[model samples]
Target: MIKLIGVALIAAGFALRVNTLLVVLAAGLATGFAAGFSLNEIMAMIGKYFTDNRAMTLPIVLMLPVVGLLERYGLKERAEVLIRRSKAATAGRVILLYTAVRQISISLGVSIGGHAGAVRPLVAPMAEAAARGRGGELSAASVVSIRAHAAAGENIGNFFGEDIFIAVGAILLMKGFFEAQGMNVSVWAMALWGIPTAFIAFAAMWWRCQMLDRRIERTAADNAKAGGVQ
Candidate 1:
Protein backbone atom coordinates (compact mmCIF):
# COMPACT_ATOMS: atom_id res chain seq x y z
CA MET A 1 0.00 0.00 0.00
CA ILE A 2 1.11 3.58 -0.62
CA LYS A 3 0.46 4.00 3.10
CA LEU A 4 3.84 2.34 3.49
CA ILE A 5 5.44 5.36 1.79
CA GLY A 6 5.81 6.83 5.24
CA VAL A 7 7.83 3.82 6.29
CA ALA A 8 10.02 4.10 3.19
CA LEU A 9 10.57 7.81 3.82
CA ILE A 10 11.60 7.10 7.39
CA ALA A 11 14.03 4.34 6.37
CA ALA A 12 15.54 6.46 3.61
CA GLY A 13 15.78 9.50 5.81
CA PHE A 14 17.58 7.60 8.55
CA ALA A 15 19.91 5.84 6.12
CA LEU A 16 20.86 9.23 4.67
CA ARG A 17 21.34 10.71 8.15
CA VAL A 18 18.72 13.41 7.77
CA ASN A 19 17.67 15.58 10.68
CA THR A 20 15.25 13.53 12.75
CA LEU A 21 12.55 16.21 13.10
CA LEU A 22 12.65 16.97 9.38
CA VAL A 23 12.52 13.32 8.44
CA VAL A 24 9.58 12.64 10.69
CA LEU A 25 7.67 15.64 9.34
CA ALA A 26 8.36 14.61 5.77
CA ALA A 27 7.24 11.07 6.49
CA GLY A 28 4.05 12.34 8.07
CA LEU A 29 3.28 14.51 5.08
CA ALA A 30 3.85 11.63 2.69
CA THR A 31 1.60 9.34 4.71
CA GLY A 32 -1.13 11.95 4.88
CA PHE A 33 -1.02 12.57 1.13
CA ALA A 34 -1.13 8.86 0.46
CA ALA A 35 -4.19 8.57 2.67
CA GLY A 36 -6.02 11.17 0.52
CA PHE A 37 -5.51 14.16 2.78
CA SER A 38 -4.75 17.62 1.36
CA LEU A 39 -1.57 19.44 2.52
CA ASN A 40 -3.64 21.95 4.54
CA GLU A 41 -5.58 19.13 6.17
CA ILE A 42 -2.33 17.39 7.06
CA MET A 43 -1.05 20.65 8.55
CA ALA A 44 -4.18 20.92 10.68
CA MET A 45 -3.72 17.35 11.92
CA ILE A 46 -0.11 18.10 12.86
CA GLY A 47 -1.22 21.26 14.66
CA LYS A 48 -3.85 19.42 16.70
CA TYR A 49 -1.47 16.56 17.64
CA PHE A 50 1.23 18.98 18.71
CA THR A 51 -1.28 21.04 20.70
CA ASP A 52 -2.27 17.95 22.70
CA ASN A 53 1.36 16.97 23.39
CA ARG A 54 2.56 20.54 24.00
CA ALA A 55 0.73 20.85 27.30
CA MET A 56 2.51 17.78 28.65
CA THR A 57 5.88 19.24 27.60
CA LEU A 58 5.35 22.72 29.08
CA PRO A 59 6.65 21.66 32.50
CA ILE A 60 9.93 20.37 31.03
CA VAL A 61 10.52 23.51 28.98
CA LEU A 62 9.73 25.65 32.02
CA MET A 63 12.29 23.76 34.08
CA LEU A 64 15.01 24.31 31.48
CA PRO A 65 15.40 28.00 32.34
CA VAL A 66 15.88 27.10 36.00
CA VAL A 67 18.53 24.50 35.11
CA GLY A 68 20.19 26.94 32.71
CA LEU A 69 20.37 29.51 35.51
CA LEU A 70 22.04 26.99 37.80
CA GLU A 71 24.59 26.10 35.09
CA ARG A 72 25.41 29.80 34.68
CA TYR A 73 26.26 29.87 38.40
CA GLY A 74 28.60 26.83 38.30
CA LEU A 75 26.54 23.68 38.84
CA LYS A 76 29.16 21.47 37.17
CA GLU A 77 31.96 22.93 39.25
CA ARG A 78 29.98 22.41 42.45
CA ALA A 79 29.30 18.79 41.51
CA GLU A 80 33.01 18.18 40.89
CA VAL A 81 34.01 19.81 44.14
CA LEU A 82 31.43 17.85 46.08
CA ILE A 83 32.63 14.58 44.58
CA ARG A 84 36.30 15.36 45.09
CA ARG A 85 35.84 16.25 48.77
CA SER A 86 34.08 12.95 49.41
CA LYS A 87 36.85 10.34 49.94
CA ALA A 88 34.91 7.32 48.71
CA ALA A 89 33.72 9.16 45.61
CA THR A 90 35.90 9.15 42.52
CA ALA A 91 34.32 10.73 39.43
CA GLY A 92 33.73 7.28 38.01
CA ARG A 93 32.35 6.09 41.31
CA VAL A 94 30.06 9.08 41.52
CA ILE A 95 28.80 8.43 38.01
CA LEU A 96 28.34 4.75 38.75
CA LEU A 97 26.29 5.65 41.77
CA TYR A 98 24.36 8.13 39.67
CA THR A 99 23.74 5.50 37.02
CA ALA A 100 22.21 3.26 39.65
CA VAL A 101 20.19 6.12 41.07
CA ARG A 102 19.00 7.33 37.68
CA GLN A 103 18.01 3.83 36.62
CA ILE A 104 16.15 3.21 39.84
CA SER A 105 14.44 6.55 39.51
CA ILE A 106 13.31 5.72 35.98
CA SER A 107 11.95 2.41 37.23
CA LEU A 108 10.11 4.39 39.87
CA GLY A 109 8.49 6.54 37.10
CA VAL A 110 10.85 9.51 37.19
CA SER A 111 12.55 9.57 33.81
CA ILE A 112 14.35 12.85 34.34
CA GLY A 113 17.90 11.78 33.57
CA GLY A 114 18.38 12.55 29.91
CA HIS A 115 20.86 14.44 27.72
CA ALA A 116 19.23 17.88 27.97
CA GLY A 117 18.33 17.49 31.66
CA ALA A 118 21.26 15.77 33.30
CA VAL A 119 24.09 14.60 31.03
CA ARG A 120 25.45 17.75 29.40
CA PRO A 121 25.47 20.29 32.22
CA LEU A 122 26.11 17.98 35.16
CA VAL A 123 27.14 14.34 34.78
CA ALA A 124 29.62 14.58 31.90
CA PRO A 125 31.51 17.57 33.27
CA MET A 126 31.62 16.17 36.76
CA ALA A 127 32.92 12.84 35.50
CA GLU A 128 35.59 14.53 33.38
CA ALA A 129 36.73 16.68 36.26
CA ALA A 130 36.85 13.70 38.57
CA ALA A 131 38.90 11.75 36.03
CA ARG A 132 41.35 14.64 35.68
CA GLY A 133 41.73 15.05 39.43
CA ARG A 134 42.53 11.41 40.11
CA GLY A 135 44.48 10.65 36.94
CA GLY A 136 46.89 13.57 37.35
CA GLU A 137 45.92 15.25 34.04
CA LEU A 138 43.83 13.98 31.18
CA SER A 139 44.63 14.34 27.50
CA ALA A 140 41.94 15.17 24.97
CA ALA A 141 41.51 11.47 24.19
CA SER A 142 41.09 10.61 27.87
CA VAL A 143 38.60 13.41 28.40
CA VAL A 144 36.48 12.24 25.48
CA SER A 145 36.75 8.64 26.68
CA ILE A 146 35.58 9.56 30.15
CA ARG A 147 32.65 11.56 28.76
CA ALA A 148 31.68 8.67 26.50
CA HIS A 149 31.80 6.18 29.37
CA ALA A 150 29.67 8.41 31.58
CA ALA A 151 27.04 8.59 28.81
CA ALA A 152 27.22 4.86 28.20
CA GLY A 153 26.67 4.14 31.89
CA GLU A 154 23.57 6.33 31.94
CA ASN A 155 22.13 4.71 28.81
CA ILE A 156 22.84 1.15 29.90
CA GLY A 157 21.44 1.65 33.36
CA ASN A 158 18.23 3.24 32.10
CA PHE A 159 17.60 0.76 29.32
CA PHE A 160 18.07 -2.35 31.46
CA GLY A 161 16.57 -1.09 34.66
CA GLU A 162 13.35 0.59 33.54
CA ASP A 163 11.77 -2.73 32.62
CA ILE A 164 11.75 -3.68 36.29
CA PHE A 165 8.93 -1.29 37.00
CA ILE A 166 5.37 -2.53 36.58
CA ALA A 167 4.12 0.89 35.60
CA VAL A 168 6.61 1.38 32.77
CA GLY A 169 5.25 1.29 29.23
CA ALA A 170 7.52 -1.57 28.17
CA ILE A 171 6.20 -3.90 30.84
CA LEU A 172 2.61 -3.03 29.94
CA LEU A 173 3.35 -3.67 26.28
CA MET A 174 4.83 -7.05 27.11
CA LYS A 175 1.76 -7.98 29.11
CA GLY A 176 -0.51 -6.97 26.25
CA PHE A 177 1.53 -8.90 23.67
CA PHE A 178 1.65 -12.09 25.73
CA GLU A 179 -2.02 -11.95 26.58
CA ALA A 180 -2.87 -11.51 22.91
CA GLN A 181 -1.20 -14.88 22.35
CA GLY A 182 -3.36 -16.50 25.07
CA MET A 183 -0.51 -16.46 27.59
CA ASN A 184 -1.74 -14.51 30.62
CA VAL A 185 1.07 -12.84 32.51
CA SER A 186 1.21 -10.06 35.03
CA VAL A 187 3.32 -6.89 34.81
CA TRP A 188 4.50 -7.43 38.39
CA ALA A 189 5.89 -10.84 37.46
CA MET A 190 7.76 -9.36 34.51
CA ALA A 191 9.11 -6.56 36.69
CA LEU A 192 10.27 -8.91 39.45
CA TRP A 193 12.19 -11.01 36.92
CA GLY A 194 13.79 -7.89 35.47
CA ILE A 195 15.53 -7.10 38.80
CA PRO A 196 18.23 -9.73 38.44
CA THR A 197 18.91 -8.58 34.88
CA ALA A 198 19.24 -5.00 36.05
CA PHE A 199 21.66 -6.00 38.82
CA ILE A 200 23.83 -7.96 36.37
CA ALA A 201 23.96 -4.97 34.03
CA PHE A 202 24.88 -2.63 36.87
CA ALA A 203 27.70 -4.87 38.06
CA ALA A 204 29.09 -5.25 34.55
CA MET A 205 29.15 -1.48 33.99
CA TRP A 206 30.68 -0.85 37.41
CA TRP A 207 33.44 -3.33 36.57
CA ARG A 208 34.09 -1.43 33.35
CA CYS A 209 34.33 1.85 35.27
CA GLN A 210 36.91 0.27 37.59
CA MET A 211 38.95 -0.93 34.63
CA LEU A 212 38.76 2.48 32.95
CA ASP A 213 39.99 4.15 36.13
CA ARG A 214 42.96 1.80 36.28
CA ARG A 215 43.83 2.42 32.64
CA ILE A 216 43.59 6.16 33.14
CA GLU A 217 45.92 5.91 36.11
CA ARG A 218 48.43 3.90 34.11
CA THR A 219 48.26 6.32 31.20
CA ALA A 220 48.77 9.30 33.50
CA ALA A 221 51.79 7.64 35.09
CA ASP A 222 53.31 6.91 31.69
CA ASN A 223 52.75 10.50 30.60
CA ALA A 224 54.40 11.73 33.81
CA LYS A 225 57.43 9.46 33.29
CA ALA A 226 57.77 10.62 29.69
CA GLY A 227 57.62 14.25 30.78
CA GLY A 228 60.32 13.65 33.41
CA VAL A 229 62.63 12.24 30.70
CA GLN A 230 62.16 15.45 28.69
Candidate 2:
Protein backbone atom coordinates (compact mmCIF):
# COMPACT_ATOMS: atom_id res chain seq x y z
CA MET A 1 0.00 0.00 0.00
CA ILE A 2 2.87 2.36 0.71
CA LYS A 3 3.98 1.75 -2.89
CA LEU A 4 0.99 3.87 -3.89
CA ILE A 5 2.33 6.91 -2.07
CA GLY A 6 3.65 8.12 -5.40
CA VAL A 7 0.14 8.62 -6.74
CA ALA A 8 -0.88 10.63 -3.69
CA LEU A 9 2.23 12.75 -3.97
CA ILE A 10 1.54 13.45 -7.63
CA ALA A 11 -2.03 14.53 -6.88
CA ALA A 12 -0.94 16.80 -4.05
CA GLY A 13 1.92 18.32 -6.01
CA PHE A 14 -0.27 19.13 -8.97
CA ALA A 15 -2.99 20.58 -6.78
CA LEU A 16 -0.42 22.78 -5.10
CA ARG A 17 1.00 23.84 -8.49
CA VAL A 18 4.52 22.69 -7.72
CA ASN A 19 7.24 22.43 -10.33
CA THR A 20 6.27 19.42 -12.46
CA LEU A 21 9.73 17.87 -12.84
CA LEU A 22 10.48 18.24 -9.15
CA VAL A 23 7.10 16.72 -8.22
CA VAL A 24 7.63 13.73 -10.47
CA LEU A 25 11.17 13.12 -9.19
CA ALA A 26 10.00 13.44 -5.57
CA ALA A 27 7.18 10.98 -6.20
CA GLY A 28 9.56 8.55 -7.82
CA LEU A 29 11.98 8.73 -4.87
CA ALA A 30 9.18 8.24 -2.35
CA THR A 31 7.76 5.29 -4.26
CA GLY A 32 11.19 3.68 -4.58
CA PHE A 33 11.88 4.06 -0.90
CA ALA A 34 8.49 2.64 0.05
CA ALA A 35 9.11 -0.38 -2.20
CA GLY A 36 12.47 -1.06 -0.45
CA PHE A 37 14.62 -0.11 -3.43
CA SER A 38 17.99 1.54 -2.85
CA LEU A 39 18.46 5.09 -4.19
CA ASN A 40 21.09 3.88 -6.69
CA GLU A 41 18.73 1.19 -8.02
CA ILE A 42 15.93 3.69 -8.43
CA MET A 43 18.24 6.08 -10.24
CA ALA A 44 19.45 3.29 -12.51
CA MET A 45 15.85 2.28 -13.36
CA ILE A 46 14.93 5.86 -14.13
CA GLY A 47 17.99 6.30 -16.34
CA LYS A 48 17.29 3.04 -18.19
CA TYR A 49 13.67 3.94 -18.90
CA PHE A 50 14.63 7.43 -20.07
CA THR A 51 17.31 6.00 -22.34
CA ASP A 52 14.87 3.45 -23.78
CA ASN A 53 12.31 6.14 -24.58
CA ARG A 54 14.79 8.83 -25.58
CA ALA A 55 13.70 8.59 -29.22
CA MET A 56 10.41 10.22 -28.30
CA THR A 57 12.15 13.45 -27.33
CA LEU A 58 14.19 13.71 -30.50
CA PRO A 59 11.39 15.02 -32.68
CA ILE A 60 10.69 17.99 -30.38
CA VAL A 61 14.36 18.79 -30.19
CA LEU A 62 14.71 18.70 -33.98
CA MET A 63 11.40 20.44 -34.67
CA LEU A 64 11.85 23.46 -32.42
CA PRO A 65 14.87 25.05 -34.12
CA VAL A 66 13.42 24.35 -37.58
CA VAL A 67 10.13 25.93 -36.60
CA GLY A 68 11.96 28.86 -35.08
CA LEU A 69 13.98 29.43 -38.24
CA LEU A 70 10.88 29.28 -40.43
CA GLU A 71 9.03 31.75 -38.21
CA ARG A 72 12.03 34.06 -38.28
CA TYR A 73 11.88 33.94 -42.07
CA GLY A 74 8.21 35.01 -42.11
CA LEU A 75 6.37 31.67 -42.07
CA LYS A 76 3.57 33.17 -39.99
CA GLU A 77 3.25 36.23 -42.16
CA ARG A 78 3.14 34.09 -45.28
CA ALA A 79 0.44 31.88 -43.81
CA GLU A 80 -1.62 34.93 -42.92
CA VAL A 81 -1.15 36.40 -46.37
CA LEU A 82 -2.13 33.17 -48.08
CA ILE A 83 -5.23 32.79 -45.94
CA ARG A 84 -6.28 36.35 -46.49
CA ARG A 85 -6.35 35.82 -50.25
CA SER A 86 -9.42 33.65 -49.85
CA LYS A 87 -12.53 35.81 -49.75
CA ALA A 88 -14.73 33.01 -48.41
CA ALA A 89 -12.48 32.03 -45.50
CA THR A 90 -13.64 32.48 -41.90
CA ALA A 91 -11.66 31.61 -38.78
CA GLY A 92 -13.94 28.64 -38.13
CA ARG A 93 -13.69 27.40 -41.69
CA VAL A 94 -9.91 27.71 -41.58
CA ILE A 95 -9.66 25.69 -38.39
CA LEU A 96 -12.14 23.11 -39.69
CA LEU A 97 -10.04 22.65 -42.80
CA TYR A 98 -6.84 22.19 -40.78
CA THR A 99 -8.60 19.74 -38.47
CA ALA A 100 -9.75 17.64 -41.40
CA VAL A 101 -6.30 17.69 -42.93
CA ARG A 102 -4.65 16.87 -39.62
CA GLN A 103 -6.96 13.91 -39.01
CA ILE A 104 -6.45 12.54 -42.49
CA SER A 105 -2.68 12.91 -42.38
CA ILE A 106 -2.28 11.46 -38.89
CA SER A 107 -4.60 8.55 -39.72
CA LEU A 108 -2.03 7.52 -42.32
CA GLY A 109 0.66 7.55 -39.60
CA VAL A 110 2.22 10.76 -40.85
CA SER A 111 3.53 12.95 -38.03
CA ILE A 112 2.76 16.28 -39.63
CA GLY A 113 0.86 18.67 -37.38
CA GLY A 114 1.40 19.68 -33.76
CA HIS A 115 0.87 22.69 -31.50
CA ALA A 116 4.38 24.08 -31.60
CA GLY A 117 5.30 22.97 -35.11
CA ALA A 118 2.07 23.82 -36.93
CA VAL A 119 -0.61 25.51 -34.86
CA ARG A 120 1.46 28.31 -33.36
CA PRO A 121 3.30 29.30 -36.50
CA LEU A 122 0.77 28.43 -39.17
CA VAL A 123 -2.81 27.55 -38.21
CA ALA A 124 -3.38 30.25 -35.59
CA PRO A 125 -2.09 33.00 -37.82
CA MET A 126 -4.13 31.78 -40.77
CA ALA A 127 -7.29 31.59 -38.69
CA GLU A 128 -6.62 35.03 -37.23
CA ALA A 129 -6.10 36.41 -40.72
CA ALA A 130 -9.36 34.86 -41.85
CA ALA A 131 -11.13 36.51 -38.96
CA ARG A 132 -9.60 39.89 -39.77
CA GLY A 133 -10.59 39.53 -43.41
CA ARG A 134 -14.20 39.29 -42.27
CA GLY A 135 -14.12 43.12 -42.04
CA GLY A 136 -14.05 43.89 -38.32
CA GLU A 137 -11.10 44.47 -36.03
CA LEU A 138 -10.73 41.66 -33.51
CA SER A 139 -10.63 42.35 -29.79
CA ALA A 140 -7.65 40.99 -27.79
CA ALA A 141 -9.98 38.44 -26.23
CA SER A 142 -11.26 37.32 -29.62
CA VAL A 143 -7.71 36.92 -30.86
CA VAL A 144 -6.91 34.73 -27.85
CA SER A 145 -10.07 32.69 -28.47
CA ILE A 146 -9.07 32.08 -32.08
CA ARG A 147 -5.64 30.82 -31.01
CA ALA A 148 -7.26 28.54 -28.43
CA HIS A 149 -9.57 27.09 -31.07
CA ALA A 150 -6.59 26.45 -33.31
CA ALA A 151 -4.79 24.47 -30.58
CA ALA A 152 -7.99 22.58 -29.75
CA GLY A 153 -8.44 21.57 -33.38
CA GLU A 154 -4.92 20.12 -33.47
CA ASN A 155 -5.46 18.23 -30.22
CA ILE A 156 -8.81 16.75 -31.28
CA GLY A 157 -7.49 15.70 -34.67
CA ASN A 158 -4.33 14.10 -33.26
CA PHE A 159 -6.02 12.35 -30.33
CA PHE A 160 -8.70 10.69 -32.44
CA GLY A 161 -6.74 10.10 -35.63
CA GLU A 162 -3.60 8.37 -34.32
CA ASP A 163 -5.58 5.42 -32.99
CA ILE A 164 -6.84 4.65 -36.51
CA PHE A 165 -3.40 3.54 -37.61
CA ILE A 166 -2.84 0.00 -36.40
CA ALA A 167 0.90 0.42 -36.19
CA VAL A 168 0.70 3.60 -34.16
CA GLY A 169 2.06 3.65 -30.62
CA ALA A 170 -1.33 4.26 -29.02
CA ILE A 171 -2.98 1.24 -30.67
CA LEU A 172 -0.02 -0.95 -29.83
CA LEU A 173 -0.10 0.27 -26.23
CA MET A 174 -3.78 -0.61 -25.95
CA LYS A 175 -3.17 -4.05 -27.42
CA GLY A 176 -0.37 -4.71 -24.94
CA PHE A 177 -2.50 -3.49 -21.99
CA PHE A 178 -5.51 -5.63 -22.94
CA GLU A 179 -3.35 -8.71 -23.55
CA ALA A 180 -1.77 -8.28 -20.11
CA GLN A 181 -5.29 -8.19 -18.60
CA GLY A 182 -6.17 -11.42 -20.52
CA MET A 183 -8.71 -9.72 -22.79
CA ASN A 184 -6.92 -10.69 -26.07
CA VAL A 185 -8.01 -7.63 -28.02
CA SER A 186 -6.53 -7.33 -31.52
CA VAL A 187 -4.71 -4.32 -32.95
CA TRP A 188 -6.95 -4.27 -36.02
CA ALA A 189 -10.08 -4.24 -33.91
CA MET A 190 -8.77 -1.36 -31.82
CA ALA A 191 -7.87 0.58 -34.97
CA LEU A 192 -11.31 -0.12 -36.46
CA TRP A 193 -13.02 1.14 -33.32
CA GLY A 194 -11.16 4.42 -33.62
CA ILE A 195 -12.82 5.35 -36.93
CA PRO A 196 -16.19 6.15 -35.44
CA THR A 197 -14.48 8.01 -32.61
CA ALA A 198 -12.54 10.08 -35.11
CA PHE A 199 -15.72 10.94 -36.97
CA ILE A 200 -17.47 11.92 -33.76
CA ALA A 201 -14.55 14.11 -32.72
CA PHE A 202 -14.58 15.83 -36.08
CA ALA A 203 -18.28 16.48 -35.84
CA ALA A 204 -18.02 17.90 -32.34
CA MET A 205 -15.11 20.14 -33.27
CA TRP A 206 -16.95 21.29 -36.40
CA TRP A 207 -19.84 22.45 -34.26
CA ARG A 208 -17.48 24.19 -31.87
CA CYS A 209 -15.72 25.95 -34.72
CA GLN A 210 -19.04 27.23 -36.02
CA MET A 211 -19.85 28.54 -32.57
CA LEU A 212 -16.43 30.22 -32.50
CA ASP A 213 -17.20 32.06 -35.70
CA ARG A 214 -20.51 33.27 -34.32
CA ARG A 215 -18.79 34.40 -31.17
CA ILE A 216 -16.21 36.32 -33.12
CA GLU A 217 -18.95 38.05 -35.07
CA ARG A 218 -20.74 39.01 -31.87
CA THR A 219 -17.54 40.37 -30.33
CA ALA A 220 -16.90 42.44 -33.40
CA ALA A 221 -20.41 43.87 -33.23
CA ASP A 222 -20.08 44.70 -29.54
CA ASN A 223 -16.75 46.40 -30.15
CA ALA A 224 -18.27 48.39 -33.00
CA LYS A 225 -21.15 49.50 -30.81
CA ALA A 226 -18.80 50.55 -28.01
CA GLY A 227 -16.77 52.57 -30.45
CA GLY A 228 -19.89 54.32 -31.68
CA VAL A 229 -21.01 55.13 -28.09
CA GLN A 230 -17.65 56.77 -27.39
Question: Could you tally the backbone clashes for each prediction?
Answer: 0, 0
1-230, model 2: which lDDT tens digit per residue?
Answer: 88999999999999999999999999999999999999999999899766755545565577778767877898656755755565548999989888887898889876665898789878898899889988467888889999999999999999989889876667766766676578998888889988998999999999999999999988878778777312
Cα RMSD for predicted model 2: 4.4
* C-alpha positional error of residue 139 in candidate 2 after TM-score superposition, expressed in Å: 1.3
Against the true structure, candidate 1 reaches a TM-score of 0.67
Candidate that would win on TM-score: 2
lDDT of 1: 0.78
Worst 10 residues of 1 by lDDT: 51-60
Q: How do the predictions measure up, each by TM-score?
A: 0.67, 0.73
Model 1 over residues 1-230: C-alpha lDDT tens digits? 98999999999999999998999999999999999999999999999767644534564577678867876897756755664565544667867877886788787765656776667777887777777777667877777777888888889878988898676657766776686589999778899899888989999989988977777777788888789312
- Any runs in candidate 1 off by more than 4 Å, and if so which? 1-10, 18-88, 228-230
